[model samples]
Target: MGRHSLPDQYGAGASDPRRRARRRTVAIATVLVLAVAGGTAAAVRGGLLSFGSSCQDDPVRLTLAASPDLAPALESAAKRAREADLTSDGRCVAVTVSAREPYKVTDTLLAGKDPGAEVWVPDSEVWLQRLTATGGTADVSTVGHVASTPVGVAMEPTVAKSLGWPEKTYGWLELAGAALRDNSLRLGAADPARSATGLLALTRLSTAAAGVEGGDTQAAAMMKALSQRISDSDGQVLDTLPRDSSGTEQGNPRRNQALVVSEQAAYAYNTAADGDRSLDFFYPKDGSPRLDYPYALLEQTGLTTDQSRAAIRFMSYLDDPPQRRLLERHGFRTSDDEVPDALVAGAGGSGPQPYAEPAARPASAVALQETLGVWTITVQSARITTVVDASASMSEPVPGSGRSRMDVTKAALQRALATFTAEDEIGLWDFSTKLDGAKDYRVLVPTERLGDRKGTGTQRDRLSAAFGDLAPVPNGATGLYDTTLAAYRAATGSYAEGKFNALVILTDGRNEDPGSVSRADLVAQLERLTNPERPVPLIMIAVGPDADREEANRIAEATGGSGHEVSDPSQIQSVILKAIVEAASRDGQG
Candidate 1:
């Protein structure tokens, strides 16, 4: 206002035409220049005019989710990178690290949900494999490894001494036998389905058990025994240890005897104990699974070029010599060929040495899936009603096998029963044309608790006997629709609390009985009967090439389950187990 004030004393100039014209032109020019300058200043204030029309000073923000145990080192490295003025291209970067459990993160991704992270640092590559198996949308690539650790048992020094720790060698079977034989030696482990270390331990146990005669039976029994000592998380499992007592050879007898965890975790715990050496890790002599901490870049749809560059920069920073040393200090091996001296000392070793015996072989995805299936069965007891088709078609011999389809199926079912625990409740039914006088299905065995055997033998024995006695009626027709509807209704009506309630239907042909319900009506009724809060999954195992797999799938889909088709009855065991696993995975889903 002071510079552009119109002269109040210019009355004469206003009256003079030429003089007024000249003053007006000059004032207009000045007003235009002022307006331009003000607009430029406002743009600068709004961060729209920085770096010559490019806002390069603004830091690109990146979010990284890392496993809870490894998050501290990642955060420290992030802070150091920021202090060092790490940038992406010509722009500054800001990274925020969050601690999240690997399993929870995997579940979120598998549910077709984004975790709002541009980078993820899972404790093992197994999670990525699982994600891929589940058809997750997140495209991830491993940039590099941050640290390495192996799965092993962490035990009290006293227990180790009793077991002849450094002087004696022990494998999974030896440890499992000790736990089974001695109730006083309380062994605890994390849930295998939820923890990589737990999964590795369980796989090792399964592999060891599979080598012996009657392996599946022995494995199931051993797993059931160990299930009693399982905890929800690794930290919880370690918490079972006795409180430290200064200068004592033996810990409190009340504490847990041993726990399955990663070598790094055990080292961290011992380090936190201030060199008291109360706990030490025991690498099973047979072998162990190793965790290679992979830094994965999650390329989400919304991720920008700048963010991607920033993630790469941060990943590279983690692999640098300085940050690698930081990882070593946290009780992790930074290299594959050589163990760091600090990690060796932290793990209670005198000199550099291998963490654990080299793994016999990496666990395959299929093997892992099967292991998870077994674990699911062991952890939760199922209430199942099995319906078998006794049509004439079932009497046909399986291709390349001398046994009839019915015989093969019955044998498979008998074997499958061994995987179930004593608490699981099971029933048997056979369906054909007019099997129960007016009814299409007949109950061969009443549903009862497997462990109960008051009048007869145990439920397992009764079920086995009934299965062996099953014979397809001559000239019988399939009653697929009516029997499925009736079985589903019965299972739902008698659904038990705190257990998976479901129907296991094995069929070899389509509905051939004219008096049975129509397929459309059955599917519609099933859809209407489905309740998300109280699920009664219908797992259909379709055997032989003639089985109506499409109808089976439709019915199962309506009730939040799945259908598995086995072209050969001899392969029914695998198909049945797969169906159980799929149903378990969809337990909480609608």
Candidate 2:
């Protein structure tokens, strides 16, 4: 059978007619759910998911972890489900909810521990993408988005009025410029590494600013400016806003007058703060990215058949009209088209604000990576040792890129180098079988501050020249294992205490040096070299079709890093940044 299923649901299996109809429109992201029943879908077709007609067979109890902000609303909906005695095939469906930060939860799951939940309702699919991006396949499946809210800049009414908020619409860059140019305007945001809201806004700002003159420089400047007032998380960033709507506290360096936040957050804050302590919102004319709370089933939770079916049953209950109202009352929109007038007003949006307009398309996984990379580098800086494969295979032409892998890889690396500031420390290495004296790797540039003067110019200048000089050594075979081990040792041995220390290796082929150390030995050495007190993440990028992703994954994972596969070298820059941000977030350094 060219198919997979949980015993029954397709071909020989059946499904609930009502459920099939309702779930047809559910937002399916990465996972497809097949309802499981003991040997037959008939029992599931009935209101009970094959459980006996008793409420006390331990009732299919499921635990869920939800994004902090969305947790309360989900709890309310779950409470209603329990009160209504919602059941899966006559068994009671009991779901317990807990609030958890998305980044922390993702890190927890990636570390291969029980996240203490069978279901996860993250604030956005972006977090889910991060999981799938690095791990190749995430062990989670999305049923539907329970609720949504657009991300926008929220400001005090007085400050918003001064900028012509209600009547005048602004693009992301225009609004960002306003915040930067006005001395009285203090703009803040959540650290992009931790908050999808902050990352999306920053990504949009980068897009908007790139269309203008001096884009790279301008974008870098904007990132630096925004980083000055970044908070650790969404909740922390909100706390930076003035306590009152009067805008008097906006003058204080500590209180931000404007912030990157979600519409629902603005609504909730306004409703609770009331009178003079309310906020106004500016939905960018271009489009506001949104937080779509996706109901994800954590597949690795060891859930029983009954438990899995019961989780789906609860998700179905959330889709009902009553639960939709519960989400809205908690300051959210069930769908983009059904904007509530009172909710919009309460969220500090009014006529001409584009509040009812359709949401902007979510940024691609690559875009999110680039945005986060920029934020991490600009704010925290880094010490990176980039190792490139100078193996003969790198000379092969990429299918659609019209350039050899080596050519494109070098260009991408240089582009990535440009995003770093002079304060950052960077180095370069090239490897191939028997490159020098039977050694697989040779350091072309020692890791040093980019701004530090060397011979006739700075270290950055020297490194750029070194990158351009790289070429596939004549008939050089890949020496991946030995090169990786040597680089890992170098990176961790010199871990810069105050900076993000990392080793980034870009390879186009698997280990071709039979004489090199065994894969098991290489991984063992890397594990021994890795230390939390002196953290150094190994970011391995396998380029082109010939690169070995599984090998890369095995070796990189030993050092608390990840292996990524790119079809072409053009994606190298974005991938590098993404890897760094992932490492930082895992360390809770965001």
Q: Compute each candidate's TM-score over C-alphas.
A: 0.82, 0.80
RMSD in Å for all candidates:
13.2, 8.9
Q: Encode model 2's per-residue lDDT on 442-468: one tens digit a residue.
A: 999999999899678999899999999
User: Per-residue lDDT for 99 in model 2?
Assistant: 93
**Best candidate according to lDDT:** 2
lDDT for residue 338 in candidate 2, whole number 0-100:
77
Report the poorest 10 consecutive residues by lDDT, candidate 2.
1-10
Q: Summing lDDT over every window of 10 consecutive residues in candidate 1, give the lowest-scoring window.
A: 1-10
**Model 1 lDDT at residue 66:** 91
Segments in model 1 whose C-alpha atoms lie over 4 Å from true places = 1-56, 87-93, 134-144, 246-254, 348-356, 395-404, 454-456, 469-475, 527-534, 568-571, 585-590
In candidate 1, what are the lDDT values of residues 308-399, reduced to their tens digit?
77777677666668888898778777776676656655665331123534544678776676677777777787788999999888899987
Against the true structure, candidate 2 reaches a TM-score of 0.80
